[model samples]
Target chain A: MTLIMVVDDDLDLAEMLGIVLTGAGYEVDLVNRGDEVMPLFSTQNPDLILLDVMLPGLSGVEVCKLIREKSMVPIVMLSAKDDKQDVVAGLEAGADDYMVKPFDPAELVARMKVRLRRSGGEVNSDLTIGNIVIDQIEHSIIRDGRIIALTRLEFDLLVALAKEPGRVFSREELLSQVWGYRPATDTRLVNVHIQRLRSKVEIDPENPAIILTVRGVGYKAGVPGSFQ
Target chain B: MNSPFKAWRTSLVIRVTGTIVLLSIILIYLAGSALYTQISSGIFDEKLNLSISDAQSTARNAQFQLTFSQYQDKAALKSIFAEILAVPPKTFDNTAREVAIFSFAKTKVRFKFSGASNFLEVTSIPKDFRKKTKISNTTQWGRAKLSYINGRNEPAIVVGHTLKIAGAGNYEFYVLFSLEQQTRTMALILNYLWLTGIALTFLIGIITFFVLRRLISPIRDAARVAEELTAGNLELRMDINGEDEIARLGYSFNEMAVALQQQISRLENLSKLQQRFVADVSHELRTPLTTIRMASQVIYSARDIFEPKVARSAELLVSQIERFESLLRDLLEVSRFDAQAAVLEIGEVDLTALVKETIDYVHPSQDRIILLLAPITPVIVDIDPRRIKRILRNLISNAMDHRDGKNIEVQIKESENEVSIGVRDYGLGFTYTDKKLLFERFWRADTSRARSTGGTGLGLSIALEDAKLHQGEIDVWGERGRGAHFVLTIPKFAGGSIRSRPISAQPE
Candidate 1:
């Protein structure tokens, strides 16, 4: 059984989330303060984290950074304010996804399922994009005999692009494919995550080679052997 | 810089200075001419008096000499007459004196002789003056021009007397005094008068310009400070100098600025507090509302195992909770607008697709109640998709509420700089008078009718505000039991103004 960690300052909301997650057949651990997340995180090592933006001891953005420093566990932030600054800050701090307050319980469960599932299970062969090689089975990418680490979300995004090298994926399409979101929603998630992925994988993040951007359309995988 | 004509119209300083200079020029010209005439006439009168007296003494001397010689022989009389005619012409040290003797025109005398002194033309004395001298006896005098044989003329005063020569008949003795000296003096005085007049006029102009500028500077400073204050620099104040009228103006202006700044900051603080209170209330309600929502959903999902009435209660609870959540959301949005904290997340989007998406979201049923009319090509515009979609959803939902089972039409049109979406329905529309109240928060068309759709009553108000945030306008047309049309027009580009409407509110 997959275990999930829930961090929020509101006791009733945390307990309610516990009830919803447990009802969905996932074991749940509820933490009240943002500062208490790491101590429990190291002990339990949950499959995913449901973090709230406002907490007693620390902010959700700081907690997310702490988690990223040590682990690659998927984090989905819960924000009460739908302000761009809060949302973008959480994403920049390495949160995989976020849902505004009062979101549907069914939708939260669906998104958690997508995050927890192992992606690219059917693709047995290695995929080549630019000078990088994507090892689907090992869930990693190698460039010039060096392994590059990526988060699960980033890995899923890359595999989705590398699977069909010739096709261009719009932000909405990628959101639906990788993040399991419906179309015509916030595209900022794709933009922020793409930057993060490039910072980790590309030689120079200023000019990307592996994930080529198509203006007014979306992004696509670069041609093989295109960049020295 | 403004044109001179525009400045004359707008600037008090320019207008006042120009008028003052023009009036001064006219006054100086009039006064200068009057002074010139008085001084010139005074000098001429003095010169004429002196010339007449001098000529009178000389005439008396010549008459006595001629009388004294009359008792002698005719030769002695001739010598006396010759000596009278030999009076010296004008010299540098003496007044210009010329003597001319003429016999009376009707006199019958033995030695009738007409002679003039020293190359002086005998016709130098005007015939009219000679005729007056012949008739008058007491030192007859008039003005004349003394002409020399060399073609030179001089303005002179001619004094005449009748001399009784014993041998010769009555002779007209005239002495001419040249007025050239007096004429030169008048010319010099006129030149001085002209220079003084021009200099005085110029000085008046310069003085008026400087004085007006000095007086208007304080007012100009006040205007500049007022502009700065209006531009939100509330700290600006006028500079005051000595205790004068202008200084009083500065003091009052500063006082007004201080008062205005206080009032504005007070209002700002009051609104800020109000916004903070509203924000806190809404945000504080969200936590428990979320918990209640999830709890209600849990109970709703398990309603099948409960009794019928209890299950129905659970469904109602969930639905009402959803409604409450939506109301809170709308209240927050309205408060944001009131605080002027709303912002746009601008992007380029195909407006036709956006409208279609909203229509489908609002009415997902396949009953074919909503029909969309748009061009084949995509109408791409820079806008906030979320807000535009909200506006469209509100308009379409409103149409559906009063549609009366009739088909609704949603038309999308675009101009070069503007895009508009119009929702038209053939249903129980509102009265024309109710158009103003349509956008009022929580206003209902019919208070007696049941709100079956469970709307929050803030939809249309929020929609109008959202359109306004995009620099757009919402126009409506309606009639009793006829139909309704709501059109929203906005600029196609961000920060652009609407130049033309793609769709009008009045249906054709």
Candidate 2:
């Protein structure tokens, strides 16, 4: 069974989330304070983390960074404030996705399912995008005969791009495809994640080649075997 | 040159200085001419008096010599006349004087003598002046141009007197004093007067310019500071130094700035606090709302196991909660606009595609209600898509509410700088006066009618605010039972103003 960790300072809301997640057939671990997340997270080794931006002991963004330093677990942040700066700050701290407060429980569960799904059962396990080769079975990318580690979200994003080499995917399409979001919403998520992905994969992140951006459209995978 | 003319037209200092210089020039010219005329006329009068007196004495000497001399025939008389004429012309230091003698026409003597010194032309004296001199008998003088045989001319005072001789007939004696010296003096004086006048005028102009500029500098500073203040530099102020009138102006200006800045900052603080309170309220309410929402959903999921009435109540609870949540969202948006805190998240978007997507989102049915008119190619514009989409959704939903089962027409048009989206409904239209109150929050056309749709009542107001944030506008046209048209015009670029709206609210 997949396990999920929920972190929030508000005990009632955390408990409520626990009840909802358990009802959704996922085993749940509830942590009230942001500072207490790591110890329980290490022991539980949950598949995903549900973090609240405001916490008592430590801020959610700081905790997010600390978690990112140690693991590649998917994190979806819950923010009470929908200010652009707050949302952007949470995303920049290495969160995979974010939902404003008072979100529908069914929708939250749907997003968590997308984040927890394993990339398996592909017809072709190996794919080439530009000079990088994505090994789906191994769940890694090989660049210049060396393996490059990527978070599961980045991996899914890259695979989605490589799956259709010639297709240009809009930000909305990528959000629905990679993040399982319905009723296409904010594009900042796709923008920030693209930057983060380029920083990890591209030789020169300033000018990206592996995932080329199409002006006024979206992004596309660079042709295989092309030298930049 | 054009820029300077524009500056002259706009700047107070330049205009004042130019006017002062022009007036000073006119005044200096008048005074200089008056002074020149006085000095020149006085010099000519003094020279005329001296010439007449000198000719009187010479004419008396010649008459006495002719009366005392003894002459028997015309030869002795000629010798006597030659001796008298042998007196040398006056030297240059005294004045360039010449003498001429002519026998009277009525003389009875046979031998008539006529001679002039220095080759002076006899015709140099005017006939009118000669006649006056002959009739007056005393020395008479007038101004004349003394001409010589060599075609040289000098301004002179010609004096004449009648001479009596013993044997020779009556003769006319004349003395001409050259006025070249006086003319040169007058010319030099005139040059000095002109130089002084011009220099004085220039000096006055420079002085006035500097003085006025000095006086106006503080005012200019105040103007510049005012501009900066208007441009949002509230800290700017005039620099005050002393206690003169101008300095007092500076002090007062600075005081006004301080007061204005303090008032603005106070208002800004109050606005910020209000925004903070609104944000805090929204945030605090959201957490509990999430909990309640989840609790309701949990109960809603288990509604099938409950009584029919309870089940129905659960369904209503769920739907009303959704409505309440939207109302809260709209309230927060309204407060944000009130605090002027709304910001644009700009991006390049294909407007036609966005419009089509919005139409699909608002009305998913295939009843052919909305007919879209758009360009063949995509219309790309820079805008905050989220806000724009919200505005479109509001307008389209408004039309849908009043569409009265008739087909709705949605059109998109573009200009060089702006793009417009229009939604027209052919349904139960509003009154001409109702258009004014349409964008008001919570305003309904018919308060008696039960609204079938779940509108927050703040949708149109929020849409208007959203358009204003983009420096855009929404115009409404409606009449009783004639349907309604709503058009939103926005700039194609961020921070650009709409010009020449491609779609007008009034339909053709």
Query: Against the unseen true structure, what C-alpha lDDT does each candidate score?
Result: 0.89, 0.89
Q: Give a tens-digit lDDT track for model 2, residues B1-508.
A: 6998998998888898888989989999999999999999999888878777888788788788888877578887778777776757557576578888888877585668788777788888888887887777677888788898889899898888888775566778788889999999999999999899889888988898899998888888888999999999988878888888988888888899899999999999988998999889999999999998999999999998999999999999999889989999999999999998888889999999899999999999888899999999999999999999999999998898888889999999999999999999988889877888899898888775525577888999999999998899999898778899999999999989987889999978
Share of true Cα-Cα contacts across chains kept by each model: 0.70, 0.89
User: How do the predictions measure up, each by TM-score?
Assistant: 0.87, 0.95
Model 2: CA > 4 A from native: A224-228, B86-95, B106-114, B166-168, B448-450
Decoy 2 TM-score against native: 0.95
Model 2 / residue B415 / CA error / Å: 1.8
> Cα deviation of B188 in candidate 2 (Å)?
1.5
* Model 2 docking tier (incorrect/acceptable/medium/high): high
Residue lDDT tens for model 1, B1-508: 5599999998888798889888988998899899989998898889889878988888899988877664566566677778888877678866678898887879887666788887889988988888888888789888888888999988888889998776667988998888888888889988998898889878888888899899999999999999999999999999999999999999999999999999999988987887777757765888788899899999999999999999999999999998988999999999889987789999888898889889889999888899999999999889999999999999999899899989999998988899999999999899867888999998888775527766788999999999999999999999988899999999999999887889999877
Q: How is the predicted docking of candidate 1 categorized under the CAPRI scheme?
A: medium
